[model samples]
Target chain A: MTQANPATLHIISKSPTHQQLYRDIANALLDDDAILFIEGGVYACCGTEATALLAATNNIYALSIDAQSRGLANTTPAAITLISDQQFVELCCQYHKTLSWF
Target chain B: MIFSILIYASSNSSQTEQSALRFTRAVLQQGHSIHRVFFYGESVNACSNLIVTPRDETNITEQWLTLASAAKLDMVVCISAAVRRGILDGAEAKRHNKSSANLSEGFQLSGLGQLADAIIMSDRTITFGN
Candidate 1:
């Protein structure tokens, strides 16, 4: 494994503008960094355009409660860690920095 | 972990601000330190103390004020977004010849660079956007 800066991204946008921004972020990021989708971003778990891009990345996860709240429990795609809030906090503790995008 | 919250939703009739508030409180309950709460876009109105909602409605501005006061959190309103959306503090309102200032107590108007600085200084920056 390559050693680099520990990074994580938290996305909570529930709007189209920010939805598009998430797509852009997923497309531009090539590193092995984790992404934790919460709030509106859970929609991407239901096969949004960004999902395909997420498949290519090695490290990424989505918040389970957020997805369930948005009625995406059954729709969450494979290879995603549907995390509880406690686990989400653990992710925050694990990563050195978090990039929050709307 | 240290955190900075970015609120991008409006103070006007939305769950965004309230959600952000709940999340911040949860973070604090977990023994985390909140470095800042940065308001942008329509959320900038949350800093205005002039907002007076009906008794039944939840007062987001007051909620923010209370939270900031209790925690001594650094509440920052985006200058660009505030000016564009007519959310002016006492000094800016006076400078612009506005009749009143509505900025919430303990909140300060600042540039977006504060956001960048928060990211640099914080371990986590959570965005609550709509």
Candidate 2:
């Protein structure tokens, strides 16, 4: 009955509260989904074990601008697709809703 | 699309509330129906009528009240979150032996169960948190 369209969650915080939110939501993700990493959330795409686990689903994307700002453009895990701000906005329009964690 | 927004940060110090409000207006302008706006965590304080802002600053509580009133939107604040943050309705204040309550108009003190129900009934449940 939960009628969400294909979701595209954007996470921009690295605080404990944000981290717990990520954990809870990650566990609840369905096969039909995508995650867009931005701001501090770029850290989550740093070739960590969690990133590896999430990459297994093939539904994650990283914001290129944020990665470049944080000097992590080249170091990001290869599994993540680097997307532009326009693509981010397009994704927002394409998804039924956006859950912001920041 | 019918959507429900969950606000989980404080109104004063965090941009979460402001961003959620902006998104609500934009979504409605985009021809979407907002099923509800659920305030939780520190954001429950957003329902407190006692929120006083500087003359130069925008009164966020008043803005929320006005928007809900104009749109006849459902504004629900989590009771647990409200109680923890010292925000109570008239009835709850009496039951809890408080002096008075200052809950803003158009905002009702509710429960997380409503959030769960909204998740089930709404087309989308978008959360704004910090």
Candidate 3:
């Protein structure tokens, strides 16, 4: 039997306000792929933009340090898990490849 | 699994470079091996020795150099990107007749072939900076 494609880890560093970036990632994301929010991308957790992402996959995560630095720790939606730098590394290892979006 | 890293953001303008550094440290700490780190676009600025950070701020280039030395990492800066950005090594500076070479130690200036090699040789290629 042919093997299935491995899941990818999508790392987004731009804010959701970048509509083009959000649309691009949304279109590119696979069902089994994971989404990781870092830097300004953590802002997505505070708004409604991630609702569509949550509908797609359960493996959504945001970098806790980035969120906390942005004062988003308290406001983050429950669907997305806050991860550490170590966990970010682990996620990269788990995925087939990491695609970084700005 | 062996991994490669691609850095494409501006080291001087964004915090993404520092994030990449922390992630790299975590990867090393977890006993994972890195195949190579290819710096491209504005990220090649990190390979310049002339960048001076204020005493209170972290010198990210120095941090990368220290980590690279400790880990014996293969850090390659894109030649085309480096040249246009004025991040030249001794040879490039001499060839171009520039005033001085500013390429930082522990980093080598190479072509995009190294990036292609990293992609083909490594199990996964993770990109940091956008």
lDDT of each: 0.75, 0.73, 0.88
lDDT of 2 by residue, B1-130 (tens): 6778888874555656765677677667666788889998888877888877889988888888788888888999899888878998989999999999988878889888999988888766877776
Q: After superposition, how far is residue B85 of candidate 2 from its true place, in Å?
A: 1.8
Q: Model 3, B98: alpha-carbon shift in Å? A: 1.4
What's the lDDT for candidate 1?
Answer: 0.75
Better of 2 and 3 by TM-score: 3
Instruction: Pick out the ten consecutive residues of candidate 3 chain B with the lowest summed lDDT.
Output: B10-19
lDDT of 1 by residue, B4-101 (tens): 98888854567678767877877777888999999888888767666779999988777877878888889998988997788888788888999887
Quote the lDDT for B78 in model 2.
Answer: 92
* lDDT (C-alpha) at residue B21 in model 3: 88
User: Residue by residue across B1-130, what tens digits does model 3's lDDT show?
Assistant: 6778899886655798888888888888888888899999999998889898888988888999899999999999999999999999999999999999999988999999999999999877888876
lDDT of 2: 0.73
DockQ of each: 0.38, 0.27, 0.80
Per-residue lDDT over A16-102 for candidate 3, one digit per residue giving the tens place of the 0 to 100 score: 889888888888888899999999999999878766776788889999999999999999888899999999987877777788898
Look at candidate 2 and tell me the lDDT of residue B55: 95
State chain A's TM-score for model 1: 0.76
Residues A8-48, model 2: lDDT tens digits: 55554453335566676667566666777765677776745
Off by over 4 Å in 1: A1-5, A10-23, A48-51, A74-78, B10-15, B52-57
Query: Local error of candidate 1 at B32, Å?
Result: 1.8
